[model samples]
Target: MTASLTPLPLQGHVLFRSSDLDEARARVAEVFCPHRLDTSGGGAFAARHHHLAGQGLSLNYIEYGARTRIMPGELGAFYLLQIPLAGGASIRNGAQGYLSTPDRAAILNPHLPTVMEWEEGTRQILVQISRAAMQAHLAAHLGGPSDRPLTFDGPLDLTAGPGAALRRLVLWLVAEADAGQSPVAAPAAGLMAGQIEKTVLSGLLDAAAHDHMAALGRRRAAPRPRHLRLAESYIEAHLDQPITLEDVAEAAGISPRGLQLAFRQHRGTTPLGFWREVRLARAHADLLTAAPGVTVTQVALRWGFTHFGRFSELYRARYGLSPRDTLRAAQGG
Candidate 1:
């Protein structure tokens, strides 16, 4: 069957559509990473890719109307969650191997080598999430950096529990896009897009089996100390202003030294570090909802971030996009 005859998802957002093998490989590579694509069985090739690019991730609908093998060694910068909508695909990510279907999905870790073979008539919805954004989310959960790279134990079960919820969430995003209500497609939808992106990332971490589950559980089980709560409240209130450690310490009714000790013990970071994280988060939100004529400098300055270069670097590390890019996206540029 040719791609034109196939009922495709995200129909209005066509990134690439072609029957030429080389052209298909090159065009798809522009959106994803470089990969080798070849016909594995004696079948005709027809390819279509429909895509929606958002703040920290993208939603894609792809189909190759032939039996094909794809070898993309080490994704390097992003994770891919692929849910087959029509036919199944055999996926091998590093030492793990599985068959992905409608009831079962596959998440490809950025650090692992992957090889996949799609059956003829296979079509799928793929979520590409930035590695930096994912790592930052994980760090927020763990309260510190992970000792090793995060890896999921797949294939993800999409029938019930968190997996089912994740599947629904992804599909909902697609539905919204198709209906012209997607934050991804709307100008000035940054805050909404950021929230959706964060929700999806968080849901993926919760649904999929991963390396940091135990640590995450432990962090959640631990109760927040009274002083820490007070300090956090103070930080939130002062995010738009320049506040020092002494101010937070005083608000929490603890000495600066004691506040530092408590933060290190319970939060796995310094008091200043926690404050910086909160400030960065606020800056992100501001950028996402920024109006036309608002500049990255204005957002950073309003958020108490004085160092422009440093703020941009940290913002990219946390949200996987530069501050200017986020602002431009919010302004519908």
Candidate 2:
């Protein structure tokens, strides 16, 4: 579908900038901290921002001054991603503190009170994506809750591995927005924003999973398409063979969790869910056109539906019709 966006001023809606520390601090207060600010009356301040919000997702790109004071209790509302473009920042979340530098990015979930202090003469690329957006993406792709903000604390070192491509894409996106020549047309821009939101989310989840793997002393090798295809084909060939996730994992010579992960990465669906859908689709086709004398029970059994009543119920639920109704409609056609 074609996409579109509600255009907003970068400085006002998506980005805020002011040389006057007071003005800058005031701007921060409008969204995060709603109180008076203490800053020099006059200073050289500049800021730029651009963003696209689409399909319950928001992607904001912002660059601001090198040194800025983040108020306390300001991070209790939104989940923010801070990517250093030129300098660095020291962030303190109560007792937990970390340094965010140009080579590294820090993710902050605003549920906890925290403060940020940007380094002097530094520039950063900030992407403010919303939680709802992450959830939507998860629903579409992974079929689960996308709760919890993920923090990857270190130099993304995107210069190597799978992260490199993403890093380059981010840089390009920032540049296009700044140049006023973003090829992302209105709707396309919105779509791109959504994709970026999902990509970031997937990265964070994958990183978390990687951390878990590390804890388990498991190192993941690069995934191979052939391996995924072998696993999928195995499932398809044995759809009615009384299968278990463990069996599939064994056939593929991987752990059950690893099998699940592979299926998610390759097919964007759980292995068993995909198998059930396949069976249901086949049953649907058979019900639609299986000769004049075919019965609903026969179609169901042929598709590995062991329980006639349950099959009929599930069939009706999935296709909005009983198997008999589907046959009748097909004959009428």
Candidate 3:
């Protein structure tokens, strides 16, 4: 599918309400991937699902009255984070099984087949993230490629720390959607929508317990000057892409902490500072030869500078003129 430029926008507010098992199943497939729901608590079976989605992430509220078992099969390309709002559920991810309550969350790893059994009155807030987008973000964060699958240590504790904070944010976003005031629903939130999705994914990677969590946060020995040169070269080559500090560190075959220490000790600036300087220089060059009808915002965004004001401020500091001034002069010349 050709990706939609706008994250969900207003299209995801559709509510699915049904009492028939077959009916609910069909509606859910439209919101999430195909899944089978079977009731074990008996009586009248009913389900409710309210889905909100962006380009790379989705937030949903789901409830199935009467005890139930949902087989989502092999997610294959997505991770479903289930946070119960009421009651509890037992989630099986591969050999490990997690019993999640209102204070806990279950992150269903994509590679593992997942089975979720809910209590009779359970309700949950579900966040679905695209696997490719998430994995790419994780690799970028760790400053190296993820050679193996990111395995969660266990269930997430929502009562404290990053997990609690992430839950609050999700709830706030959900409340916004419920009130029809969500940023994703705003027409002006195009690029901003993508940022929100990326932030959510990054937060999950940062907070959630995973095999890579330790490595990403671990401090390593400072990189040699030769390694710093390799990183600088990599940054110069891939300046146009979304290159992070981690990318540079990985290219230099060192940890992010080590790369930062080396840059400070040698260059007197952080790796990110050096990277920003290079980008500023490149943006200046692009502005000089920018095509007709090109705006400063166009040039700024083209060079991976998202915030126009910040870019202008940095550009002015480096070149002794605002980006607009530089572009204006280039056009005039």
Q: What's model 2's overall lDDT?
A: 0.55
The list of candidate 3 runs beyond 4 A from truth reads 1-12, 185-188, 219-225, 228-333
Cα-based TM-score, every candidate: 0.69, 0.48, 0.64
lDDT (10s digit) by residue, model 2, range 176-288: 55556543334556456555556766665443222222312222333445656677788778766568888778877788898888666544556676677567767877876
lDDT of 3 by residue, 1-333 (tens): 113212322235657768888998888887666888899856557687777767767778787777988898767657788888778999899888889998989998877777889988787888887665675566456443344556675588889888888888787777777666676543445777878777778778767888776556541333336897798789778866787888888899999999988766555457777677667767877887877788998888877889888998776544445778777877884
Error of 3 at 68 (Å): 0.9
Ranking by TM-score: 1, 3, 2
Candidate 1 — which pairs collide? Answer: none
Candidates' RMSD to native: 6.0, 13.3, 13.4
lDDT of 3 at 88: 93
For residue 213, give model 1's deviation from the true position in Å. Answer: 0.6
Better of 2 and 3 by lDDT: 3
lDDT of each: 0.85, 0.55, 0.74
Off by over 4 Å in 2: 1-17, 28-66, 72-77, 138-142, 146-159, 179-193, 207-333
Q: Rank the candidates by lDDT, best first.
A: 1, 3, 2
lDDT of 2 at 155: 34
